[model samples]
Target: MAVDLGQFDHPSWLTVAGTGLGYALILAVLTLTMFIVPWLVFSAL
Candidate 1:
């Protein structure tokens, strides 16, 4: 039996742009956390 692929289609540029922005934001937060956590631990000593 053949499996049916639903009506999914390519996303618009807006959707693609939003996804890019989300990824960038996630990266920025992770980078900041890496720097901040080390400083906080050392400062507390």
Candidate 2:
């Protein structure tokens, strides 16, 4: 499904940039979390 950017209030450029940054930050956090969780659980055992 496609979003209708023509109906939104935000400028297209800012929307694109913000979405990219948000995805990148989320990906980094998940990657770090996956690596740290295992070590933490093992250490507690």
Candidate 3:
């Protein structure tokens, strides 16, 4: 007899990878604008 698994469908790998990349992009943008740019401006003064 064959063993049976659950019937629920899982998410695709592409969807998971795309979501991770999008999150990283947003984090990088926020870090650059919020911290790096201001630091550079003030340090130059």
Q: What are the TM-scores, per candidate, against the unseen true structure?
A: 0.55, 0.56, 0.73
1-45, model 1: which lDDT tens digit per residue? 976554344567668889999999999999879998889989999
Count of backbone collisions within predicted model 3: 0
Candidate 2 lDDT score at position 8 = 67
Any runs in candidate 1 off by more than 4 Å, and if so which? 1-11, 40-45
Considering lDDT, which of the candidate structures 1 and 2 is the better prediction for this target? 2
* lDDT values, one for every candidate: 0.83, 0.88, 0.86
Index of the highest-lDDT prediction: 2
- Clashing residue pairs in candidate 3 (N, C-alpha, C atoms within 3 angstroms): none
Rank by TM-score (best first):
3, 2, 1
Give the C-alpha lDDT of model 1: 0.83
lDDT of 2: 0.88
- Candidate 1 collision pairs: none
Supply candidate 1's per-residue lDDT for 38.
Answer: 84
Give the range of the ten consecutive residues with the poorest summed lDDT in model 2: 5-14
Question: Candidate 3 residues 1-45, lDDT tens each?
Answer: 975554333466667888999999999999999999999999999
